[model samples]
Target: MPAVSAVSAAPLPAPPRTLGTGLLLVVLVVAFEAMAVGTVLPRVASELQGLSLYGWASSAFLLSSLFGAVLGGVLSDRRGLAWGAGFSLAVFAAGLLVGGLAPTMLVFVLGRLIQGLGAGGLGALPFAVVTAHYPEAQRARMLAAVASAWLLPALVGPLVASLIADTWSWRAVFWGLVPLLALIAPLCLWPLRGPAPRVGEGSGGAGLLRPALGLALAAGALVEGLRSPGPLGAGLVGLGGAGVVLTARHLFPAGLLRFAGGLPTALAVRGLAAFALLGANSFLPLALHELRGLSLTAAGWVLSLGGATWTLGSWAQAQAERRWGPGSRPLRVRVGLGLMATGLLASALAVLGGLPLWAVYPSWVLACFGMGVGYNSNSLYALAAAPPGESGRLSGQLANIEVLMVAVAAGVGGALIARLPLERAFALAFAVTLLAAVLGWLAAGRLRRTS
Candidate 1:
């Protein structure tokens, strides 16, 4: 990882004495928060009797998450990680409390918005933390640990959420994280040896907010558009297109708008990869439970298992990153996507073949592993391409690409599932995954040198 030390931002601050048990624990708690939501969401919808707005609950979190993450990047780059992490954790806790106590559907949705903002910040802020404080070798290891932190949560989040929802209430799942997030503030201040603020992002970062919002609006509107009827749907589509144009002008370099030097193409591949996988995977739990007749607990376990395998895939990529540097990223990404396609096909075939729900768990795990591998591969290559100072902002933009793509994909995937048989819908998704993998592979071939 140090061979790529040139990629680290200039004159890096000393990292913590060590990543420490506390920091890892903080990461674990956060990852569990992420995984818990999926399990509890259905229960919330059923209890609240707002099935029509079910997708909004998730989409709202995702949208706000985009905002929070991008904002965190800018904030952390300007302020120190301490303040950034502090603000984000407080926001996250408040959202959870609001969600747990909400009495109305609208209130619940608002709470999700708040949580999404926090979640967005929490997700990418860790990357900023690593880049800012840790040495290259230790930073890479911490990143790997951060990846692994998701494993325990992935193993238990669903199961725990399922039990809470079934035996007690869904709201408990939200409230549960409050005490956990409470620790982040104090933990942040303890290792307080850095310069208070790392560096200011200047006008370029500040100017980006409007476009991020536009992108978010475009994404939300695009998903919402799919739900409308007749001319109203057309209106929504038109609005979404405008939002995309607005966001594009702000997000990409001028050359990218003109399709120069594969910038737009790079962004497109990132978007497509996320869309094909995240979009398809979003509805998979429902497919297993609703179509295959698995219990909530069983479905939850399957998802958790998949999450666990995702960590493994990410871990493997870290090793690959060390051994292969930028040269091998494309092959890894291609393989990751190929695995995704294979997993999707296996899942689709299991459904088509009427394999018992219990028998098909491994397929979803494979899909998860594929997603993890491809995702990290994308990150290493993309980050290696950018100027070190731009890493935080570029990461935020890439994150926006991922979340926006998933938003669109989920809506599209949802509609497809509604119209077609579960198996056939899955097959179509698998085909799309294959296409994205091909695109990623082709693009990867351009990266012979680290430059």
Candidate 2:
């Protein structure tokens, strides 16, 4: 009886750390693909004589992502992280293949839509995986590592994509990623192999699919409406705006728009931050080149600096958590939002006020720093608060809000630029983004409330 007791009490094996690191690396690959695709998209449009449909390529991706995000969460909750993750990668690889071999612009856009689907799902799965697999103590560090992965892509993605487009062909860029993904797929899948752990109760995956598609359409219409010209555009915008409100109700947790406390507020804050930051980021290079008269190379370098500084900020949050603790989450969020507002406002002044070009540099660093801390921390808090079996849902909501905000920002920015003078347009965009940061700051308080 004593011997049997000792055998039963023996230590269980330690969970593999490779899973955490591999997931981060998978995010790295996704970031790189997104960054690289953006770099060469212009050439692809020109070569395929699809300048008219240029915006559609990206819009399609954004639209499809809505479905992907929700589906990923549902799948993860029902089947497990492995199934969701594997499917996303497979779909992503297929998109890359189709896009790479596409001979027409329409086909290319179709490929992008597929890619968006996969990328969206892939994006959500990482958070779900982290929540399901990682210990609370290591989650922040893992998130920090994920954030850091973006640094390399942001620094080199554009240059590499451009060089390949110039020296060889854009197809190579897409095809090139295939082999790399083949390698990454195995690393990611290696840890996922084994008996699947049920993340929730019985599978009800199909139930979420319909609403997800509706949400995707809503976002797509909004993007298209904003980009279109004249009364038609206005009509689409009106219709799409209505659809967004209606569809979002089903897509998000109840009371999200009303700022209901708990997961809803956290998700809302994330949406606001993304809206502010991505809106500003989309315009930063344009402002630098057009207003400041900097060369493209110079503008790229400035962006790179911001990306590098973002990594620093991510590392700082991890270090703070390691040294101090999680009790400071609210303070971190507040400070992050404050910095974001300050940086964007200062940048708006620099751009609109005609300050020296160099002024924009420090402003971007500050803004990126804020994003690094705020975004990662927001994810950590929201996921941490999520009820068991609902991590995937939280992840989906967070990603959905972010994707929607970014699309809205881009659409709004484009509309402004079309209507007003470049400088005024950019100034207004920056001002709007600053307001988003302020909103985020206000919303952060709700996170402390019990969900």
Candidate 3:
């Protein structure tokens, strides 16, 4: 009887369908807004006669979202994912409504600030949900799916927004998303209902808020400073830079600036990757339009194509992980960063050298692809390394840092463009991105230690 016994391996649990659907919906909505907003902002400014506060519309959302990210992380850890998500979504919806109904630019900026609070939390909450709900084996696919959600929006959001604004009104862009949010809210929340299981002790409290506020203020000052001219701009820059340095310690993991090994380094690399890719991307359209004599439409197409390729790269990493195991992450990061650097260099040549206009397409594609691969890899590493109960905090930090770096990169690049000639400004901007990518590549080895 004993000799007749048989052993069978248990099958892995299937992925969470509702959770996946809800997350994808969230990503889709957010991505669409991100893609479409720029198209309609000009209209918003003109209609409101808020050209002077134009930059603040974007800056207010960004800075407020930084605070939201921290607050959401704390809520997720303490209150549970469902509570945090619901609260964030409600805030976001309210902001949309306010923006849609806004009569003045001041009112609209207020709405944007409100939206940023919710949006930041929304951005951070997904990582906590995935970490808490999805099985370890399935995380890669889920992340890849999230990346894929951006593809549709990336492809059509701008064009659709433009059409909507042309046919209806720019406010329609804000109003349209409300119904979609209503539909998605239940799907996401129903599954997440009830208290989140405590994986570890809750960490951040109201104590962290001061530093978060400081960080947000610092970012705002820096951007405004970059936009300003002369002594006042320099003073603002110095103050903002000082504030960031002083406050960052409270928000980021220890040794982040020094690139301490493991999780800290991984987080640093993520920030650097964003700095390199997004900074370059922020200016790519301008470069193509001004330098290469491409029409705005043609330049937009290049961005859309780059976005699609980035999704492809994300999927590629997921598949690679499935075949080769999680151990492949460090190599993926390194290769991705290296490719990004190469692409930036190519873009510089295409714009500055005698290369044909067509050259920019391939170069931008390469850089975006690298971003897709490396960015996801860094995320996986950070999430994996997060201590129990700390996923939300870490994820929020991740979002916060990326946002901060991007703001800095864009601000610096914009400042250069404002002061220098077009060619020289672009050259310096590309140089900054290139330098970031190279530093990221050099630091990527630390990710292996965490692995």
Candidate 4:
């Protein structure tokens, strides 16, 4: 005891409590908004007579978020995390206000676009914070904590939103959260104040921002084309597809589409997984409400169940990482992808093959749980591999890919839904998701770099 060194005797410093709390609160609020909106979207569409534009509600946000993610990343790298975070939070709040007061579907979509800008930044900043602030050992735990933030929101958000919508108005759901943002803003920003620690040479604005704008515009065009009918729609789709192809090369790491090893594969896996799970999830409430004849509250229960399992799965992966170490990531991702595919297949059968309606609950749970496991693991893998001073950029790229894929999936699904009967459209959507999951599972094997 007398020979003990002061350094050895001291316990490791924990991550800033206020900062972590603020970040988690941000995640909590964002997750709640997502769940609530999904639950109430049918109602919104019906009231606003926007069934044709149902997909735009989600796509617009995602597309605009593409720009936000890149801009936030650039600002975080150059100006500082606090500056980017403050700007993002403010934009997010403004979007909510606009959405709450929207007089028409067009106005509501405009609000969503604004929200995407802020939400995208908010989504990417946490990863940058984790990279800059936390030690390697604590990173996984932090990511898991972020996932855990979804727990309360998932458990109660949809149900509460449904109740609010029934008792008051869906508009309340958007307005209710704005004040909470005010409370959390200080907690998150205070710890991150001042100049960002010098890491490396910051990337320039134009190279990233230009592509981000192109990506968002391309995605928007694609969604609109999907919703449109006739040859004009086909032409728009082609144009959007070409634009995405050209712009994507500038935004993502090289060999992304081909699933090159390490970062590329990880990003691809995450994007495809999100496309499968979230794409299917977007249509789930609608399916339950329209095809299965469930009440909004009952449909919300299904989503809540999925959210609960998702949290459990995330924690389980974290525990596994603790026990087996980082080497287990590929296995975890592969296993999660398998479960997702299985769940999606089961969901499709339930919708089309005459399986009982209740089959969807367990199936969704499995799918979401897989997402919880794989999505977090993918983030860890990518962050661990990030070049010095590029965490913000990497995080933005990751968020961009996920957002883009989900937007496309949802937009395509909505287009189908508008064209086909409810049952067929939902079944086909599930099939698309299932295919994505299967492909992601195959790609999971490539997560590690080859010699």
Error (Å) of candidate 3 at residue 151 is 0.8
Candidate 4's error at 173, in angstroms? 3.0
Give stretches of model 2 more than 4 Å off.
Answer: 1-14, 194-204, 449-451
Order by lDDT, highest first: 3, 4, 2, 1
> What ordering of candidates by TM-score runs from best to worst?
3, 2, 4, 1
Better of 1 and 3 by TM-score: 3
- Backbone clashes, each candidate: 5, 0, 0, 0
lDDT of 1 by residue, 1-451 (tens): 1222245456656655543455677677777877888767777787778787787888899888777877766665566566556677788889999999988766888899998887777776656656555655454456667778888887777778888888988888888779876755566545734565534343266677777777888877777776665788778878986887778677755544332333354555577678766676677667667667777667667767777788888888888777766566667867887787677667766655556555567787787798788777666555554444555566576667777777777777676677678777766755665565566546544433343
Once superposed on the true structure, which residue ranges of model 3 sit more than 4 Å away at CA? 1-15, 199-202, 449-451
Ten residues in sequence with the least summed lDDT for candidate 1: 1-10
Local accuracy of candidate 4 as per-residue lDDT tens digits, 1-451: 0111111223436667999999999999998997689778888888888887776787788888999998998888777889889999999999999998888888999999899999999989878888767776677788989988989987888778989999999998997899999999999999888777454554544478998999899988888788789998898899998899899988888889999888888889998998998898888877878876888768767778888888888888888778876777888899888888888887767656478887988888888888888888777777777666677788798889989998889778988998998887887788888888899999999887211
What C-alpha lDDT values do all the predictions have? 0.69, 0.80, 0.85, 0.84
- Among the numbered candidates, top lDDT falls to 3
lDDT of 2: 0.80
Task: Return whichever of 1 and 4 wins on lDDT.
Answer: 4
Candidate 3 structure quality by residue, lDDT tens digits, 321-389: 789767778889999888888888997889886676678889989988988888888787777776776
